[model samples]
Target chain A: MMHQKMTAITALEHSVEIKAVSKTFGSFHAVNNVSLPIRTGEFVTLLGPSGCGKTTLLNMVAGFIDPSAGAIHIGGVDVTDVPVHLRDTGMVFQSYALFPHMNVFDNVAFGLRQRKFSKSEVTHKVMQTIEMMKLSGMEGRRISQLSGGQQQRVALARAIAIQPKVLLLDEPLSALDKSLRAQMQVELIEMHRNTGLTTIFVTHDQGEALSLSDRIVVMNRGQIQQVAEPIDLYRNPANGFVASFIGEINALPAAIYQASDREISLAIGNIRMTAPRRAEWQFGQGEMVQAFVRPEHIRIATSADAGCNVVTGEVLTHIYQGSHTITRLRVDGLGPIEMRLPGGDVVGRVPVGMPTQIAFDLSQVILLADKSS
Target chain B: MTRQRPFFVQFLVPAVLVAVIFAAAMFNVLKYSFLEFVPGSLNVGGFTLENFTRINRPIYYWVLLDTFILSFATAFFALLLSYPISFALVRAERNWVRSVLVVLAITPLFTGEIVRTYSWMLVLGSDGVVNTALKSLGIIDRSVPIMYTRVGVVIALVQFAMPVMIILLATAISQINRDCEKAAANLGATPNTVFWWVTIPLTLPGILSGFVVVFAWTMSAFSTPQLIGGGKVLMISNVVYLQGFSSFNLPFAAVLSLVALVAALGSLALMKLLTARLEQNMATS
Candidate 1:
């Protein structure tokens, strides 16, 4: 009860609160009951694949969509009943939505004009925002007259010119090219630091989420898989879905031989290893499990290395990625596995159709209950 | 540029043939406008400027002015009526609702113009549906004068122009990025404000084009104004009809036709100039 109270108080102190929000269209649920609290001036990201309800959740907060159940609060006030215009939130759409009918100046001046700000005040604020967005001297340019990047900057400038209670960005970088997306990502980080406004960003790209967010909410199939910092999410995912979704991981089948409070013994084909038991898993002896290991966690073992979790496999292909090489191996009974080796050591060491021995770093192994069983 | 010629170019041959026929008809009208009208004969007399001079009279000028006014009024009212229907047609969520609106807006177009005009005659007559309904409701003791007045002609003409306006405006509304309205609302603009600021401006190009199309179409209107006006409201086409078939003054009728054509083209050119500037200001292009 005390913890629940503490959580409620924390949510009140935050800038935006979504409590048990759900949205359904006919028979399909687009967003399930999801609750999250975003603190003031924090840059939070909703990371998920397509149709994972990240955008739906963001729209509910923006008031473009209403949750079928529960309430949303902004600044400790319930705003679930409020329309979009009264919510006082600013949003940057993926398409930029920069008001093609208006020039850069008018687009940025729109929010202030709606608030009935004095002429001088409106002009002053618009000019300041344009300058901050590096859109100075292009005030008269039409939306079609500007480049993609400039248009994106105008959208950002317009949304921020209102100085809204919270800012919502919906895949704002997806439309840009690779280099431009990276540049804008840096600019977005800088903007977040400069303004310190509470921001909720939605994106399907894990790299973008990792690089730009203070914390990320990972979602799948309309449910939140895990909510953690970027490093923590990468290092310690809560489930098999998140482990594979966040990065490249290799899943291998194994059977539990013995179980203890702190350790468990697992058996693969002709190899047995004991690993520390994951605190979250309760597995019985002889239970089938799947072990997930990242490419970098497995390495080539020396000939003298014995009595370790090692296996022999033939190299299928070696992909050279400038700094490192990804070696694909076909194990005798464990199927295909991959390992990342430093470029210098991998150039000629692992030839295709040759037998190679690799050892798993037992500490980094993540095990989950085998769904097939 | 180096690929084989497009197969669709073959279709332009028939279109070119149609254009030639239209041009020949226009030349015939132009030649007849220059000829003199022969009394009590079907044949024309020698070339003269008399028919052109005859149009300088105040009666013809008044008819021309009335045509312009009626066309403008019809277009204005049609825009006012069609805008809501067009918006609803494009934004309605249910398929059945959209289908019903589409049928209601476009079914008039498939009906012949004379048939539609006659239906309007029934609705606007002294003992018509509107008058009877209004009288039964005790809103008026006597039937309001609708037929044989400029108001009746304009009302019928407005209904005639609505299908085209709805189509043009619907295309514009559908092409609009809905995000613009959402963005406006998110920036603290009310729904009314968003409508005026974002929605109206973005669809300005379509609205102007639809208005101009309806205006030009109503400029040449003949049947509705002729039947509804009942000789009280005189449009240019009605005057041409009277001169050509009733008075057998084909030359004068040809002259009036030429004048009406020039007037319609001139107004279209003027509107093009105005809308070019508007499209530029709105950045719709």
Candidate 2:
């Protein structure tokens, strides 16, 4: 399997290959021994909470930080020891780090000028990038004169103006307001599509990771948990961390699992539920397993419900979101279980301290091996 | 409801008292500059502009020119030496390194001006530490005459002005967003290029203020030039002292003092104008 995977990695035209890269500060491992190969023109995101080594990994790729062990290959060249200036990676800093002394044109022209481009070529490229970033007439304006979103665009323009081999974005949209953040996300997508540059973005926001990345590398505790496409990652997380980190889900208590060719049965507390057997169900018949169910999959039980999947609980709280209401219920043995219903109608129907029955949509459940056992 | 205010007026009382006394002393100096100095007498005659006219002579012109040149050189050299120390003080990765640099940079300020000037004399004198070291190293066979020279005066003055320059520069450098430098490097600027293109321009305000402050401070320098220059390199301050004490021409001394004061104020105004233009150019909202 390892040999096949290695051959597959070598067969593709990977733009960046991180080989067993690790960085340790004193005894704390910021990035453990990890390897990832990014294909050309791929938009990859390192998604994890703060201090989980996502930014550290991105910085190592950008040549801002060096790995204590292992090699980084960019464009088929070993650039592990290369200094940041020599590393042909364009980076947009989170603060937008636009030169306050220079106007938009000069700031965008800086990288081109460093490469010894001709005066007219620098002007042409800068103008083209500014136009692409929609910063057309603001070339003469100082960075401080531009609005926050405009400054962000200028930062992007400055980084991409050089047409680098790889573009690295370090949480570049995190500083904007909610509305502006949504706007910039669309612009970022458009920019990525237009440039087709192999980009690696680092962000702790799972929503951004899900929306922006071609492949999301979910990470935790200085190691990669899983790397998959957006829908596959959200639907089939490799572990409990990725499942809970990606979206809201309820982790039922450790349960006994019994599987057959046609169906898989799980016993949680005194409640029993049966799910249609998936081809990927590789657990032993009597193994201990944990079940994760998304809030949307579980709903209020109607009178027609007569199965063991139905559980009784008292409503704890109702959080009314604009399009949906998240109702929290304290189950007898399962602690708090959250169910997402469409609209605020659930708030008037289910008051606090009222007992109700919630049925799990068994087909949509996610089962992982209970490692604690 | 009426808001209860803090005692801001009470806080200004001591400062106002000091300003009043300072203004009275300055008024007395202005009055003396307009009076006539009776030769060899302690008293002054009716108001006249003779003292101002005496300032146009080549000898006094040389004194004023020397003072300006020395002060400018001191400020320039002090800025050069202080910049590296200040950068290290602010940017050192180790806390102890920053602490050591701060202590060394500021320890000179605690010493009295007379004491510091006397110490420089010992270092710059014939057969002094520098001369003896050079002679022993065979770099020079003869003891170089640094004492009573413009070089000696400037060297002493530059050292004297560095503590203030470092403090101002450290503050400016610490306030810089380091991400700017990192971004410059990420855009293919070498470390050297980053320093010149980003770091230096970002600290221009601090540089301007430090230069002006050192310039003004060095203009009124008295004991450093008096002791180190030893009457050979006469600055306006030393000339003011000579006229007041040796020549007993209080009016002439007051006129020189006024000129020094005006020169300092004029430099500060120029600095203000330059900084305003800079702030406008690099307008950080």
Candidate 3:
């Protein structure tokens, strides 16, 4: 029985393919030649800052806006001109966009009514969905009467009640408090697991995107810079934008010296290191390149460690986070390189203006592109 | 009413004074309605239903019905005209177009209804501009007589009624949360369905009052029917005027005015009932 159900689910096969899509508002381009393939039942997040056209791309997929060039296909069928109502794609807007004129039950039942379902079937399904959303007896309550969390649940129930082929979320948890947002994120993940719906979420919050998405599509200036799984995206960013966008990075400009089959060289502040390159970093020898190492990857020590990428500097400031210490070190030519260490575990008990030595793994660092205008 | 320091009255005192004046004014009308009319004098001492019975004739009844029919038709036509204007004013993307429409809506309201009616007379009369244009266009062989007909009165009433409906409907449509329309569309409702189901239902309260106001105004209208009908269309207001001033039947005129008041009040009550039920469900939803 489980095998049959798995096969049936596999037969559902509705992969979304976006082909060279671009959207322009008059003379200004909002999305530029972006292509992506979202596999069935895979949750993909289009992550970027405001005005990055992540929302525009999601809107095009929802059929709210037509792409200026190229096409969008759902399950291999082009639905470029299809209106929003015919697309059968569920969207959870940042504002929730729940019907203020409808109760929870009526809000959930709206799509069913549009399909002209029998009254009993609509009532039964609405009841079940409302319960599944943990809003049972509150079905008769007005939207304004419910709390923000309950209202969000009602909005989720409304969107998922129809069981559309794809679920689209546009910063749906933005209105919630931090604690509630974290809780709702867990609920959303559980919901995705239960339904196995292909979901595309657009968010400016990197943490939200990284935590929720199986794969993250990082965008900058309406162009996709990187698309990979959460771990791969965080560990191996493709460019300077992705490196700086994902997490805090201590980057310094360095000239490549020894470019070879398995290794490359970068010079930073009278210090040179032979960094291993799994593949060619696309730069010849004697070329300027930027190396980025995250704060957590750098180890601060009082004693010099040989055979490691070591840099000696003075501690500018030591910020005590709850369980960690972020020590800001001032090195020659490099203004500041931060080293985040476990609380009270950093050697020599970091003090402001005290001399310190920091060492990091060259293998863990990445070369980034220069984005100066 | 004084607003000066130390010359100000308390809110409750002024409110009581206003209520007392209202009661006295209504009592005076009631007393005048009860006064029986004799040959040379009104018998103020007598109590009788003779005036009410006098207005029960088929001629008066038909004229009263005509007034009611005219009121309903004018209100309906005004509502129909106002809906699209209100929708545009509330939904149009361009501010200039909305502002222009608003100015157009306000221009009609600022003009007195009599002036508007006179303007219509110039347009709709036999030798008026509209008839001349129609004749020139070969749509009609001769001047079309319209100034003294029900159509003329209806046209005048509609002209007067539309601005009120537009203002009220625009205010009502503004109060509707736009999210409801988006929600309707998201739920697979077509644009037309969203408009009819969500937009219209939400704005019904606003348009409902617009209808009642226009209906009451049209029912009590004296100048429009008098000027446009040219003493031909005998609406109830005309009948009341004839009884009170021309025919010297004060009692019958009072009875007719009372009937007019009752009709207006009844229609308002019906409007209230219809909208109240709809709003109750809407509130819960």
Candidate 4:
């Protein structure tokens, strides 16, 4: 059965293809010339801040907004000129736009009915979808009677009941509270696994993008910055934007002291450190570069860690989270630097206004050319 | 204890005064309805049930039925014509287009009823604009009798009621969550289906209220039917005028006025019941 399904999916060229798509409103370019191809049954996320064109690209794919240029294909068929209803793609709006006038069953059955399904078939599909979404007994309830999370499920069920070729989610979890949002994120992962539909999720929350997406397309200023899996994106960001955006990291200025094929030496203020040279680093010796280090990679220095890769700074503040603590320090040339330590041990050990020695794990450090200089 | 609002007495004084005057006038009308009508005199005699019993005649029943039918037709046609205008007024993409629609839809309300009715007279009269245009277009060999007809009266009343209808419907169309329509379309519903299933249902409350309001407003319409009807299409108000002023039977006229008021109230109550049920079904708070 799995092999048959796979072959059926491979019969189509791709689940969704956007080629050189652009959308402009007056003189403002909402989405610039962009192209992306989503494989069958893969979950991709378009992650960006507001006005980054992620939503615009999703709208174009849904056929809600026509692109100013280029073509769009769903299931290997060019649907650029097709109307929204004929495109056969499902979209879950950010507002969870379940029909207020319809009961839960009707809302879920809407697409099936529109597709001219038999009454028994529509009922069977709707009930199955509602069960999958865990909304069994609430089928007769009005939309206003449901809580925010339940309404969200109904919206999802309504979109997926038709079993469209591709599913579009426009920040589906943004309206929920933090705990509920996290819970829904897990549910979303399970839903994706169960359905295995080609899905494109849009969100501005980087943590959500990192956790839920199989591959994330990070966007900035109406352009794609990078496309990679979450782990690779966090570990090896293509530029300063991705490095700063994906997670908390300190960007410190450094000068390349010496360069070789295997290792490179860098100077930060009066301190010196050496890092294993990456193939992507083509900078020469004596050139300016920016070094990025994650907070978890920095730790308080012990007596055994004496000479290289250690810097002294005054402790400014400690933010004690339940599992870990984040400590802020002020170095001489690096400005403010944050370090995350496990447990509350660092909070009691390091007092404010006292000098502390901290070491950087140079193996995980990220180096990029200092473009501002 | 609740805090006392300042100037409470001052705020209550004008409302109290108006209510007192209105109550006194209605009481006089009620008293006059039971009194005997003296021909060729403004004075009335002692109390009698004759004025109320006189309404049992078939001619009076026909007049009441005519009034109800004309008001219903006016409200129906007004709702039909105003919905598109209201939708356009609320949904026009350009600022200038909305502004133009608002001005055109509402400006007719500022003109005097007499003035507007006269304007319609010129349009509907024999050898007037309609006849002249139809003649020039060779659609008809002779002029149609639009003037002094029920059709002419309803046409004038519909135009008169459209401004209010447009305002109510426009408010309803604007309050809809646009995402609902988009969601319907996204879920494989055609544009036409989306409109019928989603947009129309969402605006049902507004449609009901607009229809009822126009119905009640047209039920007591006096000048338009009087001028345009030219004594041919005798609505309740025209009959009341004929009895009170021409025949000098104030008691029967008061009875007719009371009947018109009751009919209007009844229709409004029916509208309230329907819209309340609709609101409950949608649960749109």
Using lDDT as the measure, the top candidate is 4
> Tens digit of lDDT per residue, candidate 3, span A191-225?
88877778999998999988999999999888999
What TM-score does prediction 3 earn?
A: 0.81
Q: iRMS of each prediction in angstroms?
A: 1.9, 1.0, 3.2, 1.5
Positional deviation of residue B186's Cα in model 4 after best superposition, in angstroms: 1.5
Residue-by-residue lDDT tens digits, candidate 2, A126-226: 99999999999999999889899999999999999988778999999899999999999999999988887789999999999999999999888899999
Residue-level lDDT of model 4, residues B133-219, one tens digit each, is 999999999999999999999999999999999999999999988889999999999899999999999999899999989998999
Q: TM-score winner among the candidates?
A: 4
**Which candidate number has the best DockQ?**
2
True contacts kept of 3: 0.42
Better of 3 and 4 by DockQ: 4
Model 3 spans > 4 angstroms off? A1-14, A118-124, A257-265, A270-277, A280-282, A302-332, A336-363, A371-373, B1-69, B89-106, B126-151, B171-183, B216-220, B230-285
Predictions in order: chain A TM-score? 0.91, 0.95, 0.92, 0.97
Ranking by TM-score: 4, 2, 1, 3
Stretch of 10 with least lDDT, candidate 3 chain A? A1-10
Interface RMSD of 4: 1.5
Check candidate 4 and list the clashing pairs.
none
Instruction: Evaluate chain B of model 3: give its TM-score.
Output: 0.90
Per-residue lDDT over A139-257 for candidate 4, one digit per residue giving the tens place of the 0 to 100 score: 99999899999999999999989988899999999999999999999989988887878899999999999999999999988789999999999999999999999999999899999
lDDT of 1 by residue, A88-118 (tens): 8989999999898788999999998989999
Q: List the residue pairs that clash in candidate 2.
A: none
Predicted candidate 2 versus true structure: per-residue lDDT over B194-277, tens digit per residue: 999999999998999999899988988999989998889899999999999999999999999999888778878988999989
